[model samples]
Target: MTHPICRACGTQYAEPRDDCPVCLDERQYVAPGGQRWTSLKELQAEGHSGRFEEQGPDVFGIGVTPEFSIGQRALLLRTPAGNVLWDCVPYLDDEMVRRVEELGGIDHIAISHPHFYSVMVEWAHAFDAPVHLHEADREWVGRPDPALQFWSGRTKPLTDELTLINPGVHFPGSTVLHSSAGDGALFTGDVVNVGPDPRWVSIMYSFPNHVPEQPQKVRAAADLLAGYRFERIYGAWWGRVVTSGGEEVLARSVERYLRFERGE
Candidate 1:
């Protein structure tokens, strides 16, 4: 009967498929059905019975590495221009790299596409840091070793308080990285996803079903995330979003996805 992964993101695709074809098809689903798997050491033994949550002040949410999907957690900020790892989790051992080198080893490791770019060269050589990725998804780097570092076009600072904004909109170099901390955050990994009315956020075109047949490039990726003022907004799992505001919830989710894709 084995088939229960993806309670949010422990990808294990090989056979016996039903959904989660890279995050639920038909433009992402899971309204009340969407979850299935059978192997990968049972989602890494359920992320070794996962546990870890801080919430604020350098936010942290660990849990979901085991079979991944139970709110898939990974967020630890200390931006003063250093220590940032937006999205990355396919499970990394060694006590999660010694609790992230006692909190300071990771200098940088950005990711908002390529399926969360899991493992990411083993979390960038276990914190020697440097795994940017965005050269147009780099063909969905499913382990394109060599410590990876693609980047190209539209902003990229990395220190002096971090920066790396693409705003292309959901893949195709869909990027977003702007965190000076506190009331200034924007690490949108799915181009933007944080709803359930945490203030507002909902704009998609293909969130796993391929819906960008060209609605003006999904409103030009929500007009490149409406310029940015991010008071908080980080999404990739769970209730989606680790924080809030995030420039009025990404400008009311791009005017409610441009009035539901012009069906106005």
Candidate 2:
């Protein structure tokens, strides 16, 4: 709990440092007010509590009430195989642990990118679950731990019904999960961001800096996902979800993005 966590990115470092590399990266920004630091113990004392809401059938969106750090919500995907956590938040306590355990607990954890890797080791320890992260982004990991398991390649099947696919977009190892729930669903954590229009989605190299993703990379993501069957797309936020036509939405989104990028 005392480990120094970046206030801008919510990344908990193994040791204290004057700066957070994740924030300083072009993909993210150091807070305008300047870099600040906090710890889980401090957040608990500040009365930051967990917020849980059903984003889909059994997918619960979890985050801190005061929206700490990047303010992205992690998803508790209760798949038929087992309960897998899609991402992680910075704040966690006994209550959050107890609450999650009551919901069948977490069997595995998979993060989309480095920005959302906040206190993941904490969550993994709480539930005795292993974390699956892409190896390409290993250098960005704030705190290395045995609980973190790295995989390299385009896809790794977690269960009979779920698979992790790297789109190679926002981050070199940016991952998205496909679940055979209902018509199927893709759990993306800002890797393939669900846009304001639920029917559409977007990809970016640096969302904070408005940097466009490479046209080839975006096209490759869509091509890779074209093989899956999904109706819903679950984004990384509280309400950012595409309820239906997940496959078509992704295809169209990439086509439009490429066309626009080419000034067609």
Candidate 3:
């Protein structure tokens, strides 16, 4: 049986489904006219191509090979300790593995939420690495593949050098990773998204569909992150990182959330 892929997020599902289960929630949706599905062999036969864009010395944005209408991207943070694949995609193959290996084999895979848990097991096996998922979001795990090593607790160190932060934003277990990117930097998956304004940082209750959030949760998450001094925030997608004054922008974002939550 052939499955359909959600054009909204590029996630494939078995059989013909009404709507993307991942998007059916408040955060995402299918394109107006629906989507197209292609098998691995079929896609490869067409000579489809995808590539990664270098964002910084050790950061990259991985997008669709042909560049879909919606350029959804994920981050690949490389550090001396190891590499962290943040927010994954549904499509992965040997070619992708080879490319990643050329840059440096991945050591850890962490996602912001379950929706991004696409082909995670396949990814883990490719690099012989363990997936670091927050304990609070265990139920949301889409695959629950045996390869996943679920970890409970506020934070977990991948290799004594890398750290994962769960501020509880988009999801109860929605997390961000804070690793030393040379000089001084923090890789915030989506807990603190870089707004359209490069200088401003943003957050929402739901990001897939642009739904805003209540102030309480925003404030709490912000408070949780106040302890860190990050000069830059590496967001989930392309052009979503603030290079300077990131801490101040984070505090301001929290203030905005407080006002919205309290209706002030």
Candidate 4:
């Protein structure tokens, strides 16, 4: 039996349902027509395929070619310890699996928040890797599996150079991965949105709904990340990378966001 996937978010459900709880939430929205579901087989038949592109040294971005739901690219971080897959996408194919296997495969799958929890269990099972998600947002998980592992607290170290930090701006468990490779890079999955401008990043509660995050929450998130040292910021999607001065961009963006919230 083919598992049903949410048309909006592309999260596979444990069983078929009339409505997707994730889309019905205020943070997300159901289509005007209604809730629609599609299976991965259907998506593949429709010509959706996953591909990987090298973004930096040992860092590759994997995403669907035709662009499936939410259209976020997953980052494959190759480290000396092992490979870490950050923020999964909707579609995974044989080619993707083969390519990943060629690149040493994934040891751990970490999601930044509930929104990016797309087909995580499928990916984990495929690679026999551990799936890590924030414990606070466990309710949003559509498909639970034995590979799923819940974590709490502000910071969790996945490896010597890579650490997951919860900034708590978009969601209670919204996270960013700090890597000590190269100069340093932060793999932020919409937690810190690299924007229309490369010099700034924004925090939002809901990007589709145009809901801005609270000023205090944004400040607190930034404060929490201030301890980290990273020169680049990689957002969830393609072309959303802040190439340099990521630390400065975040500081200025937070200040600007707060000022606007205060009507200054």
Candidate 5:
């Protein structure tokens, strides 16, 4: 049986449900027309195909054409260790799998937050890789699977050069992957949102509701990330990458956010 995928958020549940908990949350919203559901097979039949683009050096952006659900593209990080899939989309097919396999199949899968948790299990099964998620947001997972592995802590090391840091900005378990490739790059799936300007990043409790994250929380996140040196910030969507000065961009963004929060 096909799992029910949310038409709004793209999260696939183990079975059919009346509502999508992800969309019902404050960070997201249920469609004005109300909740609708679809399956991966249905999406494939509807002509939805894979979209792949080079986001940066050694970083390939993977997304869906015609933009399904949240429309956040996943990044295939090609490190010397292997390819790492940062974040996930709701749709996947045999062709997409074959293309990735040709480029060196995925070694591991990591998601930045709950919003990007769309059909992660499906992807894991396809690649036969482990899905690393923060234990804090375990409740939000729509589909429980044996392949899903939960980690607890402020940070977890995936490789000598790659580490998963939980800044706890957008969600309690919200994460960002710091890669020591080239100069360095931070893979943030809307956890540290890359602004439209491409040079600025922002922190938000809920983008859909226009809610600002707490100043202290933002400050703490920035402080924790200050240790790393990243020249680029990769956001969730296509073309939302900060090509250079990622570390400075994050520092300035936090200062700006806190300054405004203090009403200064």
Candidate 6:
């Protein structure tokens, strides 16, 4: 009686379905062969394991060993209040649970958007932590649970130092975690992509489907983020971090995107 998980996006469902609504949407695409499904047990049996690596003084990146669905790394922000789990992965095992517990268990779990909402309910239940998700994207939730908490507004503060900022770029509820730790860092889960240049980040409506966001939407997202002071920006993947000057980089990137969109 294992819940079915989408192989492409890693979203768990209350029951088995022919296709994952998230993947079938315009933002994402089903595989060429069609929709596929897998279970956590099946993934674990195939040798998928989760591991955490220190990215900064109190920030760690948690990801699967063999790279599970979507292949996005979850960020662990450790603070005096407690640890916050940002985003999630598909596969979770005893080893990963024990390791996270050793690091002082997750106090809260927050997802940036529906695309990164992979097995979040399971994670919350494991740590007895509350899951925070934006109300705008509540329909995208696959597995409903009592631990899920839906929020609205442009920003929601988790702790005095950490806040969830919704820029509304990729999705209506696209969110990023802003932390005052380590000269200020933004944990953006593909809402603001850390471009290859490392000095800039780009916003997109869809990464997989090659959909671009409107110029005004991009500008608005940037303007919303301008209110915050962040020195570094961390994206969902490994090695996708802007080491410094995140604010300037984001502004420049927005301008660049707008310029290109206008054929300037």
Report every candidate's CA lDDT. Answer: 0.63, 0.92, 0.70, 0.90, 0.93, 0.90
The C-alpha stretches of model 2 lying farther than 4 A from their native spots are none
The Cα RMSD in angstroms, rounded to one decimal, for candidate 5 relative to the true structure is 0.7
TM-score of each: 0.33, 0.98, 0.86, 0.98, 0.99, 0.98
lDDT of 4 by residue, 1-264 (tens): 678999888889899999998888888889888888998889989999887898777889999979888889999999999999999988888888999999999999999998898789889988999998989889999988889999999999999999999888888888889998878999998989998788989899998899999888888899989998899999988888998999999999999888888889
Count clashes in each candidate, considering only residues at least 3 apart in sequence or on different chains: 10, 0, 4, 0, 0, 0
Error of 4 at 75 (Å): 0.5
Could you give candidate 6's per-residue lDDT for residues 1-264 as a string of tens digits?
Answer: 689999988999988889899998999889888889999899989999987898766888999989878888998888999999999988799999999988889999999999888899889989999999999999999999999999999999999999999998899998999998668988898999987789878888889878899888888988899999999998989879898899999999999888888899
Candidate 1 ranges with C-alpha deviation above 4 Å: 1-4, 7-25, 28-35, 38-82, 102-175, 179-204, 213-217, 220-264
Local lDDT at 240 for model 6: 90
All models, RMSD in angstroms? 15.3, 0.9, 2.8, 0.9, 0.7, 0.9
Error of 5 at 129 (Å): 0.4
TM-score of 5: 0.99
Worst 10 residues of 2 by lDDT: 1-10
Best of the two (1, 6) by lDDT: 6
Estimate, for each residue in 59-128, the C-alpha lDDT of model 5 and write its tens digit.
8999999888978899999889888999999999999999899889899999999999999999999999
As for candidate 2, its clashing pairs are: none
1 or 5, which is superior by TM-score?
5
lDDT of 4 at 7: 83
